[model samples]
Target: MATGSPRPAVLRERVAGLMAGTLTLPLGGCRAALLDPQGPVGAAEKTILLNALAIMLAIVVPTILATLGFAWWFRASNTRARYRPQWVYSGRVELVTWSIPILVILFLGGLTWVGSHDLDPARPLKSTQPAVTVEVVSLDWKWLFIYPDQGVASVNQLVVPAGAPLRLKLTSASVMNTFFVPQLGSMIYTMNGMSGQLYLQADKPGVYAGQSSHFSGDGFSGMQFDVRAVPATDFKTWIDRTKAAGPALDEQAYGALSKQSTDVAPYTYRAVSPGLYEDIVQQHLPPAPGPVAAQPASQVAPVKKAS
Candidate 1:
């Protein structure tokens, strides 16, 4: 009787099953969202993180091993090891101490400088495909995502086509907040009367987690959202369904939606009013002068009305 090795397919399946089991372990087994990203931007960020860690560990590992080695070699029972009590300033020791740290610092500084420009939130993504524009307003404890091209909007949920670049225009309707999607990288700030830009893309169909990384108020813990990426065909189908079944997002509706709240359920709208985002930004601005603007409080003369 001849004994044969396991087939390639069976071997692959067994390995995959083992990986799945390990990933689902109870304690901290949930994957690190930043390290295991679903998009290009997130992957780049993860690379930066790993490179920095490796550079530091280059120094750390040897130092730890040398410490253990010294401890064991100079053990009380060991008689052959030489004593270093009289040694104080060796050239080799000085060189190793200064040069290695200096080199690490220089490398880290250069790496940070280059990475800063590459990961700039305002810089547009480099891609051949057309980008989709989404206007985001950070309201009290909730996120509002507006799809300009589709003329639709959603609260606490964002949906886009996988493999297409996303161009985001972000602002705040109330307090300042941060719009962050861990799997897409980049955390951009949103403030009243100011707009920020961010570029991101999902490489495949999946639902990624998004949240307000910055603390806002009591409801900060509930400031979470979902990013759903689907195929282009499915994205279009979603748009059509939203148009047919969802309600319109107009000024009055937005006013109600902007009120302070917590744990707001995700919902979509079929239609969004044009320039609504711009209007929200304008509302935060100081009133502009009229044809006959009021004089400054100090410059104005006191008015004597009939008593």
Candidate 2:
């Protein structure tokens, strides 16, 4: 395969190999998903996580070392060590113990407050590059990505410009699921009949792994997808190519695609039905009854809406 090509399996293996050499740990193999991020959002999130760990470790590490040192200093064999039977409640020790933890807590709290807002998924990224909006529907064991502007759709594959921001409007077509692109940042739940928003940006051209982090049903294990970030020119070329050769995504085709399944391969559509995503959301609810004409107040009893 070409080095600059969009080959998912090959790229995954390469990332895994890089992790093996650079990030080997005692616990298990390196997790490229969380540790090796590919975008600004993911990098920021990783920094927050590492900062929290370091803040806690500042106290934990010193406490552990002090415990060991004290054990050796107060050992029974150390006859020269001072021993006082009445020694208790030293003001210096109390001050040190309380002050260190209080400082640590204050620092962590500040960091959390700032990081949470900075990484808010609903917030749009600050950039001069244009943003691409994708409508994502989480199915039983698959993912559907619809590009309204391009009037095309894809299954289990999301392609976007490398430098342009990606705005995702997501909802579940069936049960609750999560839309996660680990290398691009946080995961958010996709609940039935409700929509969620997430913004992501890829810093360079590459392919990243995406999956449904939340388990839904029997085929949950295979609910995986690929995110391909290419150059702006290439992205436009891809859209044109799909429009020329991909299949049409009509209502019947969508109905068949939304059913429960596993390990589906990626495919594209040249066109999609208008308001298809809204239709999918509406399908989860019971159909609304036809409007009833107004009647005389004395002849008809009043009806109350369901709570």
Candidate 3:
């Protein structure tokens, strides 16, 4: 009775001071970027994800709890246990087991279909400010980001103006890869002969990590970068620094640069060939005959459909 049993000694475990908080939802730094989204598309996607998660957990949580509770209750020692020796399914219970999960699946499928379509990476973000286009080339194990507008380029580091919409035109020179900037947007794939796009914006100024989620071998573990969100004016300074540090990247040089490799450090370039992205988009490599001029209607053969 002495002082309420001398209060249990306060014991604490330090994990770099990042002690986990909450059992259900752990503490996170930029959770707002995901759940408290800044745009309609993000909000919709986040809603669908959350709802789907909750719906699944609705079943999972109860099942796990029931399993544990039933395990203990049905133990041989408990005289209160109602042993079912000749058990048969009840129509009502069966109906519930089937219909409930079916209904939940249908709802989840509907939400996924709608959200995925609406948040299609290729779909343009509806906003007053035009997106800042950045062409991304996935290298051996590095990221090459080209700021076409600013006529600058960099490796492993990308900077964008805060509040400005940004789009990435992504592709890989060799194996496939997934570009994921956790706090900015969802992951999108990059593959040879195919291009993908990801739209994003940073609500506030900060440095966020961007990584290649998919493994691409040797240097896959090191295939990560920094996404620097800064003020518009600061972006200019960044450009100048890039320009001062790196020589111009030309088509011929780019060809050599694009070769497979990984674990590269940040590099920058002051200038690049104009329309380089368009060329790359169309699979046009220098000295490879610009791009096949679009076939004119007259030169194209029109075939009739068979009945």
Candidate 4:
């Protein structure tokens, strides 16, 4: 007898195994960044998350067990199970059910309220050393980091010193986007014609991944960068090396960079035009062209007035 296609049950089992493998593939070698933090802000946020989960599970787990118990005890075969035909709502049960959720709500609310102000993105982190200010600009599908004090700039790469606070002034050159580094905590928005402030710190030296969280356009998927946190001495060495090479980021160079492109390689600018950041914020250097401006207003025909 010729064996045809495999049985349905076996085929389903094979398909399920393939699907599970596919789902776990992306998570290979990946640690849960939110739960395993590298900085003070991220650790604090993780604590809140775990606390919230435990609080909810306190009520959820018991409710699930109670449901299973009731189903098994009241089953048709359990002749000893009492049936109360006239049973109305019990005050004790109502009190227990309602009080638990109310308590959970109160606890969660208080936690959020305190954490928000404590970890405000604009609030500076306390450190013995001075904070490093890096002006961040979100381009179409890239990030431009300017170290004004150091007189140097870089594209798609952010380098800072470990154990030192970071003061970030973020703005967008094109559409609005969000700047986020999961392991470092705090996500802030970057908008064109407006600037926002954020403070962060890395307690140790490591490379953290960063990206634009908000959807911008076709190239949004590739708008990723790496944050290199190094020792103070290494940070100074990097700045010197950057200053010794690469072309100056002048207006012409910036204009060219503002144009839409994706997956830009990290590069440094030996020198940057003074006040370039301020110019972009103040719109002195015109905002980058966006989707709205892709089609000129003059090209569209005007609507006629009703007769």
Q: What is the C-alpha lDDT of each candidate?
A: 0.87, 0.87, 0.77, 0.93
Query: TM-scores across all candidates?
Result: 0.81, 0.82, 0.74, 0.85
Clashing pairs in 4: none
Ranking by TM-score: 4, 2, 1, 3
Tens digits of per-residue lDDT, candidate 1, 1-307, equal 7889998999999999999988778647348798788998999998899899989998889889999999999999999998878877889899998998998898889889999999888788888888989999988778999998899999999999999999999998877889999999998899888888999999999999999988877778899999999999999999999899777999878877877788999999999998888887888332212113345668767899989
* Candidate with best lDDT: 4
Best by TM-score: 4
Which stretches of model 4 miss by more than 4 angstroms? 1-30, 292-307
Candidate 2: regions farther than 4 A off: 1-31, 284-307
Clashes of each: 0, 0, 2, 0
Backbone clashes counted, model 1: 0
Expressed as tens digits, the lDDT of each residue in 1-307 for candidate 2 is 4457758998899988998877656545356688888888999999998999999999999999999999999999999899999997899999999999999999999998999999999999988998899999888688899999999999999999998889999988778889999999989999778888999999999999999988777778888999999999999999999999867988878777776678989999999988888877777332222123456568766798899
Please estimate how well model 3 matches the true structure, expressed as its whole-model Cα lDDT.
0.77
Q: Of the candidates numbered 1 and 2, which has the greater TM-score value?
A: 2
| Candidate 2, residue 98: lDDT | 99
What's the C-alpha lDDT at position 278 in model 1?
89
Residue pairs with backbone atoms closer than 3 Å in model 3 (clashes): 140-261, 141-262
Candidate 1 matches the true fold with a TM-score of 0.81
